[model samples]
Target: MTHPENPSTFDTVLVANRGEIAVRVIRSARAHGYRTVAVYSDADAGAPHVALADDAVRLGPAPAADSYLDVDAVIAAARTGGAQAIHPGYGFLAENARFARAVADAGLVFIGPTPDAIDLMGDKAAAKRRMADAGVPLLPGYQGTDQSDETLLAEADRIGLPLMVKAAAGGGGKGMRLVTDATDLRDALAAARREATSAFGDDTLILERALLHPRHVEIQVLADTHGNVVALGERDCSVQRRHQKVVEEAPSPAIDAVTRAAMQQAAVTAAADIGYVGAGTVEFLLDVERRDGDHQAFAFLEMNTRLQVEHPVTELVTGIDLVEWQLRVARGEALAFGQDDITLDGHAIEVRLYAEDPSNGYLPQTGTVEAWQPPTGAGIRVDAGIAAGQQVTAHYDPMLAKVIAHGRDRDEARRRLADALDRLVCLGVTTNRTFLARVLRHPVFAEGGATTSFLTDHDVTGVDLDPRDVAAVAGWRQLAATADAERRSPGLAGWTNATWLVDSRPLRVGADDRVVSLQATVDGIVVTVDDQRVLVTGTPDALRVEGRPVHLTVHRPGGDRLLVHLPHVDLDVSDPTGLPPGADDAAGAGVLVAPMHGAVTAVAATVGQQVEAGSQVVVMEAMKMEHVIRADVAGTLVEVVDVGDQVGVGAVVARIDPADTDG
Candidate 1:
């Protein structure tokens, strides 16, 4: 029997973040025969990470500034818990170079790249320069130190039209702008600089050439101190909204063998150049529909020094546990396998299920997970952390779970994912289930014609909100009304009272509005309107309409409204007379309201502050994304809210004084 190489292993490790990632880290560590410690804030005392760890320590209150991002608090937790290492799972302090240095100075392994490497790659401009120096292909744009509007315009003209303005120290799509014309260059530069300054504490701006309908592809690379590097194929993250990834899939449908090899080789080269000694990703923008459709070229788009949120897709295809490798590398082990030893099989796709309203422009939603039940079946994996009754608070990211499906190929994977989504049951809050299901079933997506602009080009506004469906709901309500009339007074059925029948009844079902006319019958009950008959069977509590079983629960009073549980949607049925007037509106004014329940991280707008439409007024930290509430109309701000205050849906954060209204 042969012993494993570099058998050294730490007995205890600390997870430096909260929610699903922390829980995920703890599980992986335990599987590797290591004790785990969890650190959380007051809002996360009942979080899954705290409950699952061998030891739990509370940092501070719910606000991130006071806990997760506090270096001293995390170090103190590590000391008290007697942990030997710390794993900063993706957000919070994952990319903070200073924190990494502090961990090393405290004689604790950081479980990531060296602090020098993090500092070098953490700066976007500096990393780009390093990549260029390493003989890697870079975007044909300016990486200069000048931020003047005149110099930026000249650089844009030189780089050609339709260029991108990006922050030198930004990730997750913050401080990014797309300018299509020369007229908007100066303002765009100023805005980008301001955003960059606010987000990364650095305001330097850079220019990049924008590709039209480009596919976003990235390569996963791993390295060790033994001078070995391996590329784990590619992932297509083209489907995005507001520049944040919504769906990710491995074995990208757009790249062929030749293009795949080129990208993978480039990723390996980038890692070796940086002396990267951990898991990192090399992002690229692939052109899909050129004269040479088979010909693919890529440019370096920065490297993430830690494990990515989409790492599961790579794991599903390559059969490699990246967390295990991070542990192995920390133990000073040499590369166990060379590049040739790594193999990629099957296809995998991951969908980020967030607590946000898709119909409401994908605005983040917050509340308790009233009823959270995940689907269980073959070839489906659910990486979830929150339980059924967990509170989806405003202090963290809005993602509820990550649903991934692996199959023999892309089509099978898509089919399995769609099936899993169909069986998913989530109550109380709105989700992106129906919208993502439509994406999976979309003809273009099935054909693999998706790009970064797929969500923008595809029209998902009218899906599941049709007026025809509303009329069908009206049919269900007519049955309920007839049953109620019969149950109220069985003797009055034959008399056919005139006063009992003429009232107009309105019902609000789903997102549509409709009116139903009901008539009573002698037998059970015959419901008819517009020459269509809806047969009602069983009692009102358990209704069978048109040979379909439905569990009906009345939500409010007036006895006219009921919830019909269906496979795809929850139908709200009510009499037309009971329906509220002036509902189902999709228009609004220029007031910037809170996207979800969150504290105002920064309130930049002041009364009488002149701003153009789309200028950021407030930054709200909700879910995982930093949502910047922007101005919808060009006007002077009339109302401003203080920072560090709580806000929620329709809660006005700022209001633009009307041009016509007097002060």
Candidate 2:
């Protein structure tokens, strides 16, 4: 690890990030024979990365601003741990120029681009000017110095309607909004500014024409300190939700060899022209509607000065360890190979599994993971920092893990990824596993025809609970009750007894209620759902329903609730077996509740004030995104919560009484 050009040999590397990316860098650093230090928030003290590192440092509490985003705390940790370099793994302070400069000032290597490079590209406003000057094709929009509201409004009108207002200081879909109507421009600007200030500490924004049904394509570029830069190829990240990427694949199904070469060259030129070093991605938006045969026109989106979340696809196809190279470049090492030496083999696809519910507007979910079973196949890989009993909180990003698959071709890779998603089990919290599997297996995505509008353009509904799932839980509960009562003799396959009380159990699974009648018999426990009876014979883990074997991982988390992990979706069922038959049928949305655990950022309505349907009642911030709680019915506010109040999930934030009758 010694280099004559750079005499400072770094034996210890500190990862200044969290979640899967932190685990990712730590693994690579350890593989290269370097002692690793993991910096974590109080929330991540028991995280996988902390356990994997040679030593660990606590940054602060769970909130990122006081912990991962704190520049001084990170530098102090690097110094205390005797780390020679710090790797900001893709988020938090990854693209922060101040953090990069501080690392250099502290005599430690920042394993990314130089501070100047970060400054040039981290701010989207400045990056657009530079790229445009460099002759990169771009959308016509405003990226000016005057950030006044009047100026922005005039510029926006000039740029025309249906444009995007984005935060200049950050990426990853934060502080971004699309305005289709002229009347929504003010609200969009205000929301974008608020989110940007909270996310990136900069309210400066840039506007761009929102191309209809465009495909997001990005090129991976790696440069060494010795002026050796190479383009590793392109990845299509067209499948998205809320401007964030969901599914990504290498060697895009949309573009051909000729367009690939052109895009690759363009990325190389941009990276080389800016004197970029280390791992970075140059993003582009392909106008699918304006396609001309094999030559689809793509415009420069932005250049992320740090590694991208979807870099795994590039790595799988190119057989390159990106984190290892980031360390090497930071240590002033020259590239061992050049552009001609690089090769792309096969195909790869990756999907991010987040702790979020798909049916309910994709609201973020937070709960302890009772079971986590990642699928393992020939070419499947799981990058995660989660474990059983890990409490996923709402203070950070909702993404829990990433599942990637590699195969000989696109279809093979697609099918492999879909299968892996189906087999992956993450219990306790609601996740997008089922939604992800649906995306991979969707006809458009499988055929490589997905655009940025893929998720919204098509109706990809949330996974429904299977009737067998309801039956399994019911049977298991009955078995447990009978065994505890000691009513019968011990029998086959962990069954201790049989139940005498042959009563019907009411189960509620994700807003749907069903009555399940059970009968304990000599053969096995029988479960009846909606007049249909099925013989369920098995333990809590595996069950044979109606003579067909089904594998399920069940977790009974106290009092009447069971979290069942199936092939696609994890169902959290409310099982009330003993009490009574007539359960209260609660309905109506008279009171507005916090959809998730979060801080009330804004109080949009006042008590006694009238609000129409879809009117904003309260604004809540959680997991780095703002969720506006709106009125579901036309009513007058009877109660309201103040700003800066911390509320838990389902806590009443506001209440609205029905509007007065016309008579």
| TM-score for each of the candidates | 0.85, 0.94
Output the number of the TM-score-best candidate: 2
User: With candidate 1 superimposed using the best TM-score fit, by how many Å does residue 326's alpha carbon deviate from the native?
Assistant: 1.7
Candidate maximizing lDDT: 2
Please list the Cα RMSD from the true structure of every candidate, rounded to 1 decimal place.
5.1, 3.1
lDDT values, one for every candidate = 0.77, 0.85
Model 1: CA > 4 A from native? 1-9, 290-295, 466-545, 548-567, 570-595, 598-638, 642-646, 654-663
lDDT of 2: 0.85
Instruction: Please give, for residues 189-292, the per-residue lDDT of candidate 2 as tens digits.
Output: 99999989888889999999998788899999999877888989899999888888899999888887777877888798888889999999999998866754
Estimate the overall C-alpha local distance difference test score of candidate 1: 0.77
